[model samples]
Target chain A: MKQLKTRTEQILATMPILAWVAFAAYVIETGAVLYSYTISFVDPEAAKDVYRGLNLYRLSKINFWYYTQAISLIAGLAVSKAVVAWLVIRALTKFRLENPFTMDMVVRLEKISYAAFGTWVLAMVSNGHLAWMMKETGELQGNWISGEFIFIIALVYVMSQIFRRGVEIQTEHELTV
Target chain B: MPITVNLDVMMAKRKMSLSELSEKVDLTLANLSILKTGKAKAIRFSTLEAICRVLECQPGDLLEYDDGNKK
Candidate 1:
């Protein structure tokens, strides 16, 4: 069991790095998109050609409200993803296999769950808005609320409860000498 | 919390030092200190028996129930 736990910890140790890389990639992509949008706004003709090449010219023509909403949605998702990645990295760095049932782990699990849930809700709402916008424009919008994200949220919540129980058991065992 | 360890009292009565008791009982000083200082949550029967044998006292001599609210 101890060997298995160590192996699991070793595997999980890489997850934070993966998450951080994903977050960095998302930031870069978002920055490029924002830069493109800015150029499009500054020079519509030039931007139109650029956007057309990127297949985002239709989105560039959206109303002010929709545009702001889309930006806010993207920003929200990015911020939450970054926060989750940061927390996961911090938690994993501090994690000790010898004593895994700490309050820090519980807090980290709960925070991760909150971030996942927030991401799920934001994705669902933003996807709905996108679908509505697409219907108005006679375009098809892809589904954004993924089952994997929902599963992650649920898994984190369950893990948090499990950690809570582990903490209780550890305390009892310690008290028992 | 109402049940307190009287390990110190028993050790004192037996004129046994912590180290001596530890060596006799084949337990660590830290563990004995924990028991003496009433920090131990529970004592194993084997440990209790060992301590009792060394101190020449019963388990009751090393443990006491004091109701703070009654006082």
Candidate 2:
């Protein structure tokens, strides 16, 4: 049990780094997509060929509403992911293996859960909008719903509850003797 | 709390210092201080027994029930 706990802690300690890397990748991908759209606007004839071949030419002419929706979706998801990463780093930086049940841990877990839930909501809405846009453009490539986001949100919520219980038990134990 | 710890009174009656009581009871001074200051949520039977034995007193000597509403 001790070995397993240590291993788990080690993994948790590395999670902030992984989350930040993922967030960075998401930002870069969004930037690349936006750049491609910008190129299509600046040089329609040349970029049309590229967009057409890629079957995303329709996206180049997307209206302001759709464009803003897509941008907001990307920005919201990125911000939430970054927030989770930052919270994890701040919360677990001084974690003690001997006494893992703390109010600080509980608060951090709660915040992470809220951020993950927000990300899941944004992902769900964005997937719906994207799917609709694709269908409108006659490029229905199947739904883009991210089950991973929902799963992560649920997992974080459960972890928050677990930490809450841990805090209660720790309090009781402290008062026992 | 309705139940209060009178450990300080007993310690004083026994002419014992906090450190001396802590050594005799095999508990840390901080913990003993918690008991002395009535800040402890609960006390273990073994700890109570050790303290009672070391101080040469009964449990009743170290605990009191305070009814605030009583005249």
Candidate 3:
């Protein structure tokens, strides 16, 4: 990725670095969520710590099991997002500037798109779970799901399609005299 | 493909080895193999000209179009 063919490609190499940073951020966020969840269980009073603008730990006072369930759902969503971020990092690392269009790249891009779609689905499920939990215990707080992933999924899916076509065109070009 | 390369047929008729044709045409053996095997997606006018010149064949002799689902 550090190859210096042009200024544009030099800038392109920075994309992988950004993706790695994003991946690290997601990993750290996942760790923080898990740490908070664990701390909340150890000290029920610490459940008062607000996370994602939601006083989810307060639910522990109403119903301990339900609070655990809510926290678990949130953790699951976090892990799914981290997985998606890791997939993005993997795709970025595998990407090549020289002879970039290949079947391998198409497959990796497709995998990343699929992973993003899965994350979106998990986000929807977690959003529904949070709503249901709030209704069951009469606690409506901040939003757990931002409508961000729809655009992400669409963009990545479209990128994968473009890469697939690129692979086809590159193959045709290589085979042509 | 409906359109196909017939480089091997003309090569055989001219009694030229792939390497000999490649040397005369100044094309790589691999490219000549691709054209001969009909694996090439397209041929350039320059390459077709070189092959035709070496094989003493017309473009029609080096390429053919078969209607229907022959491929």
Candidate 4:
């Protein structure tokens, strides 16, 4: 429908900054947690003891801290992707570029496409790494593979197509309209 | 052949000024001028419909083929 008025566009333009702020807050929170409670600040041995105590269920628990770090990394990356997308859309509107097919849109979409592909690759490889860690603790027998991983792979394919189609639409719109 | 605008005829029949037509159609006068002078590369069907409704005319009344003006 794209009946965006001036006021709406202004608000939409601010959304990416808001997302960045929120993502930064999570990063800061994680940093704060690492600094305050874990005696790992002054004594590596003490930190190891604390982690070992919590990871007492290392045999039963899933790949512990590695999983948490991976999730946070993926989340931060998702936020960055959103920020980039919002910026490109805002810049296109601001410059009054013809459509998505111009050099500008191509570059923007390319960045998104590459990011999506790279993230999928990272996730897949990290899943392998996680599988290895899980095997060390023998947690791979029951839930070695997450169905969500398959979903993520599928999402990568779908999004790549979507990004490609958006480019095509922009190109056609520019040429014909 | 090129499309020719019949803005003068519509304006005369309605006794409407460009400003009046702009207000009636809720479009900027500059945009209306662009359409009137055939300077615009494209026009939305909605805009054409609005113009037809406000002027009580058909698309043929506002636009015509001018093959003789091919220069």
Listed in order, the DockQ scores are 0.49, 0.57, 0.78, 0.06
Superior candidate under DockQ, 1 versus 3: 3
lDDT of 1 by residue, A1-177 (tens): 889978898788887788779778667656655666567567654334332244445555655455545555665666666677777777888888778899889998898899878888888888888778777766433435664679878988999999999998887677553
Position A2, candidate 2: lDDT? 88
Each candidate's chain A: what TM-score? Answer: 0.82, 0.70, 0.83, 0.45
Q: What is the C-alpha RMSD of each candidate to the true structure, in Å?
A: 3.3, 3.8, 3.4, 10.5
- Pairs clashing within candidate 1: none
- Candidates ranked, most accurate by DockQ first: 3, 2, 1, 4
By descending lDDT, how would the candidates be arranged? 3, 1, 2, 4
Q: Which digits, one per residue and each the tens of the lDDT, describe model 3 over residues A1-177?
A: 334468767667787788777777767766766677788767765666536455666578888888777767766776777777778777777777777787887888888888777777877887887788778988645445577868977887788888889989988898988
Better of 1 and 4 by TM-score: 1
Better of 3 and 4 by TM-score: 3
Worst 10 residues of 1 chain B by lDDT: B34-43
CAPRI quality level assigned to candidate 1 from its DockQ score: medium
Error of 1 at A87 (Å): 1.7
All candidates' chain B TM-scores are 0.93, 0.94, 0.91, 0.89
Share of native interface contacts present in candidate 4: 0.05
Question: How far off is residue A153 in model 4, in Å?
Answer: 9.3
